[model samples]
Target: MISLKKNEKWFWSGVVFIEMILFYSSSMTYKQQTSVPFLERYLRNKPLAGSLKHFGFNYGGKYQSIENDGYFHFVEFFVRKGAHFGTYLALGVLLCLALYTYFQKNNFLKILVPWLMATGLAAFDEFHQGLTGGRTPSVVDVILDSAGAFTGTLLVVVIVYFILRHKNMKKT
Candidate 1:
């Protein structure tokens, strides 16, 4: 049997929790996931509406379906993409922390493994989306998600390197 310290347990638990959320959300149809109604209500006050009214994103043909949705959809587009990036970023960080001991001596693996795992999750997410109605899976989204994961794992590597360097300086 494997033994885990308290911190390790926490990190692993977080990874599982986030993974569940990602999977659950992915399984939902785009219509089910839409936040437009909520956005509509919140922006009805006009002050907030005016500020973002003309805000636009020059999304490519891939997003043509949403391009005509006006301001609310524009905000939703960003919020959705931001969710994709941020969720995977957190997943990458938690995975790296949970697996740190296994890759202690191999700095390369320390960065690579978590990113790969997160990318795999992103790929699976796209696949799941395909199974849902009104959802079209995009390769571009997987790329965006992979970038987020890479950023996260690289952040962990840098932080650990600095901490080790500071400890060595203290010893000398």
Candidate 2:
């Protein structure tokens, strides 16, 4: 078991709480006119659809194809997935930092513990979404969330390693 100092405990707890609030808010369905109209208006004029089509990227589906009325939907889908990735990335960072602060002796534990916690939270978020009125759970989303967590954790490890190395060099 790892014991955190008072300030460290408060900071990590705040991060976890913010992540939970973000997940809860995202579980709600956004009405089309609320924000989609604004995004659609912007994307329709940006040539983004044409650019994607030029790259041979086909957003295939009955309602999500590039040749049909799916351009906005395609863009929106990526935007939503990007949000999932980014949010999980932040969660991963906080978890990794918390674990590192308490378990500084084990490199493996730092990575493994944060990864497991973030992945579990992702699964729980998906399940919660499924219970919402218009949201459906997806295994692919869980995978994406896990990948984001891994990337974030790896980034933190690299950053901390370099910082520690620099500090040691300065000490000599």
Candidate 3:
């Protein structure tokens, strides 16, 4: 096992915690995870409903398409997919941070490792969903999750590059 500094420990812990949440959420049925009722209660009263009404897309799931699912389900589909993106984005960041101590000078590995790991987790999560009732494993969701991880890792890479450049400049 590799010895970790205090900050690295925290970062690794965050990665583990996030992974646990992803796994736990994946084990649940779609109905258990639905936030549609909650969204309808609050969002319908807000001015955003008018703008959201025109925003439409077809989610061709096993049950029904978005056209048959109506407005609230359409919104819920986006919300659910957004959660997938955001959660994996966070996982990518945490994984990158945790691995930074080992890969500080290796830019390629720094970005690649975290993204691959996060994508692997996304794939695993989708597989786990396949085991749950009312849940469907989707390749599109895995792709979306990968996109999120890529965006996150790229963000970290860019930020670290600038920080390192600034430090080197100050040494002159």
Q: Each candidate's lDDT (Cα)?
A: 0.82, 0.73, 0.81
Candidate 1 has its poorest 10 consecutive residues by lDDT at 58-67
For 65-169, candidate 1 gives per-residue lDDT tens digits of: 333677677677888989988988898888888888788889999899999999998999899988988888888889889989999899988888898799889
In terms of lDDT, the poorest run of 10 residues in model 3 is: 57-66
As a TM-score, model 2 comes out at 0.82
Would you list the rank order by TM-score, best first?
A: 3, 1, 2
Error of 2 at 24 (Å): 2.1
Model 3 collision count: 0
Model 2, 32-130: lDDT tens per residue? 213457677776675666676543242222244455545676566678778878878888888887777766888777788898889998998888878
- Over 4 Å off in model 1, which ranges? 1-6, 45-60, 63-67
**Winner on TM-score (1 vs 2):** 1
Error of 3 at 115 (Å): 0.5
Q: In what order do the candidates fall by lDDT, top score first?
A: 1, 3, 2
